[model samples]
Target: MTINGDGIDNPYGKVFNQTYPGRVILSESTSRTSFAITVLQSTGMASDKMAPLLQMTLSHMSFALYNGLAGPITIFGPSSENCDEARDPILITDWGHRSAFQEWERELTGNPIRPQMNSILINVIIDHILVGIGQRYHVVRHADPKNETKFPASENGNYWIRTVPAEGCKGSEDGNELDERQGFLRYEPEEKNKPQLGNNFSWWAFGEQPLWLNFSEPTIMLLDEKKEWPGDYVIIPAENRDRWVYLVITAPKTNELGNNRTFISLAHPLHLHGHDFALLAQGNDSSQIDDPDNSVVLKFDNPPRRDVALIPAGGYLIVAFKADNPGSWLFHCHIAWHASSGLALQIMEREEDLRKTMTLEKLQQVNDGCKKWNEWFADTENLWSQNATLFQDDSGV
Candidate 1:
């Protein structure tokens, strides 16, 4: 491996063949960002065998970089399958970062900084949705127990808190009848909508035995509206086309019962399908929740827009997007583990319009797909049965 346009010999006058070892600094200047690295395989091996081997390493390096994981040092080699010998050099080019915000500003507005004005502000709290056995431990029934700020209690005496499960019936591992409830991470409106506690309610519990047990079907939860049940998925309706929608996603600080002093915060890389959103602000200040509009700085002038954004641990992220796309889009956590464990929701934008566009042929295709999946699921070998070999461990994202 060698830096393009650089001398083959080392700075110490040592003639290095096939490899050059040195520090290559990428300056902050935009012009200095674009550069090339050439890799040459000195071995006279068959191109077919060497190309795949070298490509495998390159692919792994690229995957590591994409996932923000530690990767191998910058290096490359020539292994083109078309080429017979290793004489052919492979040149890898680095295209410097493309400034989307800057370009958008230059094209639309001359000002670089502008405040974002939105029509609707939606606050979404993202955190661990945990459900546990109500009989095993005591669930906090109030946000402020000392102040007597009692949360609406479910039928089984458990509080309708965001951190613990609501009351309901659950089957124990020993086949004994036990009561279950909604856990942390549920739609807030459900707490008030159905204040009357019921006994038949059940919810998904994470990290428990009978791994596949307590699975909940996906449902969309709408803001400002009464939810039919707790833990329903969220839906964002586009009543007007191209309306600005602001989302304030927060990851509240959580504490366990045994260790109430230590707060648990986790990072979530959230991804939104069908549209790009501007990241207005993100930080570790929970106080901004009181006055999100005034306290948090909003970026309007061509702010960075992307499908995926990170919600920092014990912090919040503000994003805004236009509700122009007419489809059911999934807004979910990018982390595989979290997403699988039910850290996801659906956004039904312009459901009426989307339904209008779904023709008979499209509907048939969807029905066929569902039929195939059901057929596959019905196969005893595919399901978790007494003689079944396969078991579902992760949330089928």
Candidate 2:
């Protein structure tokens, strides 16, 4: 076996490859505008299972079939935490200190099972999203921009999506420089509407998910006045099969740490399958791009190429790669638990890969899996609508 081919590929250059190493290949252009589902809930009832993230793999398969690609998806958009203030009860940062909140803890003990009843610990989200293909879809959530503060002026930021810490660690990237700007122009909200720069909510997109049928709300625009741009994770179809296409992943943050603690667990390895990407930047230290010290940055050009990128916790990581290869590829947190905890995603690298590897019949199974999964979620959505309440009735109660 080749040094990089251990059937398990660890993007951190640690162990085996982080994904299904020998998947088939093709081109990305033949694929259509596939789905990038963003399922964000307050870290639920402490005992939630990691079973949900499995749906991402299924979604990948489903969308891939729709475009006549392989049996599954290859490049999936990252699933970061939304942490809707309207929904999440306890900000995840307060996990170990339930009693520290005093009055809230007293009230929560008697109330119904609110997601906040057990603080939405980062550990919990990680545990759920990174179960099976955890390594493929590295976790990404929100934190205050490393460069700005929350109060008078606001900067936005991001962190892990699901996958939890190795040994039950909690909170956002702790003890790190709070002034770091991984992404963003720097947050300076002028007033409510008169955003000095951009508003703080661009970190998470609203339509990233499909129409919900259950208790949870579909990704809906909450801001009454300022709504997010309609499509964020868009996949533009390349006109010709001969052209080289690219998928650019910008891990940017703003200045606002609602519940998230720190950045990707201090160089928590991230891995993508089918094809490799050039990591443009990891933990860039620039406060301003013009400065030489910014740890976070945006690349106007391509960086380097690798299948896995180990991004430091509490920093910015950017990746750019071609949709040159195909087949069902996976992307997730290299952390096993985080992958299962809703961080896993898949991609159909390109049409050529599918054309070479997937037969018309096997592709049918991919279609079947997607159908079943969507139907299942439809029921779940309906359930959430009927009985699921994202919030406690009253923080005072």
Candidate 3:
């Protein structure tokens, strides 16, 4: 859970981001003790290029060739209660390339985030497993005064939510001593007496631009095929260019589907592809999040930088990342059923630059793949029902 030791530490100094949602059955012997992990050798490299290494432990097992032999390897460690280690140093092998190693070391030691930055707001919905930007929608029923039951006028209405400024919010003001070591913000806001710059950038709010979400069509593929932005897809402009982009993702207590279930508010393991985001603030209580008298405290200094973060049921997660990488990247819940239910959105960063990278050959490859898939999907052997015109039940993603 702690990538480079920047997440919440428990009493034992162990990090716990999210947990298994379903029931877990533990053997009597293994209870509060050792656990087993299954590792699969899934490399296509030749035996000469492959080496036996302990997965996740970063331990070099052997440099000897395996000759394509597959077997189970047992790796036992301390119990979960006492898994914390004092120090785990990593050794970088130069492999006789001194100049190359020096260059990599320099880049690793440099600043991770850019100075000037812009931010956006993203609302995470698990009431029915759907994700969208700024807009929140509700169904309104307009019924007749005399016969309310007779009217079937259910309408969908949406509006943009006002953004909270970072100044009034309780958090850090300027970068601290842990700025470089922990990926904290080094530059101060241009405005005076406003400490909200690191927390709230004041540019975007919830429900910025809603997507024309569908069950089957992929947004990026559609964009590449058409060579234009589809009206339905949300294409956020990277106005700051190379600056960092922050996104405040909140799991509100109430949404269009009413409130999150009272019996069990599921914790969502949210993940973003392409780049690791810095988790600035993670709140657990939804009730006090917006309360003026009792606002949730955010950690702008030395926040946890990770690719995946958990949004506690009815809570919020604030993350920031540099906009240096350009492409259509997906941000979604990690749960399979949740993602399948359409809890996802695409971030089209540097559209111009992204498009330039998509060459004619790549476009043709995409088209070829699509053609083959369509043919296979249309085959009667693959269909569950012959009469049904559509086959997709959830967001194809």
The candidate maximizing TM-score is 3
- Give per-residue CA lDDT, model 1, range 1-397, as digits (tens): 2122222211221112323222222221112223232221111111111111111111111011111111112213334334332222222211112221222223222332211111111111123332110001112233442323464545444343221222321112233222222133342455112212123211121211101111222222122245442333344455567898787877766632221111235656676656667888878765576775858777888886555677766678889778776776656664433444345665667766776777778767555655665576556665434673433333334
Q: TM-scores across all candidates?
A: 0.42, 0.32, 0.44
**Candidate 1 TM-score versus the reference:** 0.42
lDDT comparing candidate 1 with the true structure: 0.38
Candidate scoring better on lDDT of 1 and 2: 1
- Those runs of model 3 whose alpha carbons end farther than 4 Å from true positions after fitting are 1-217, 224-239, 254-265, 287-289, 295-297
Give residue 43's lDDT in candidate 2 (0 to 100): 12
Of candidates 3 and 1, the better by TM-score: 3
* Each candidate: RMSD: 25.5, 20.0, 25.9
lDDT of 3 by residue, 19-106 (tens): 2111222222122323231111112111011112211111011110011112222122335443322222121110111121122223
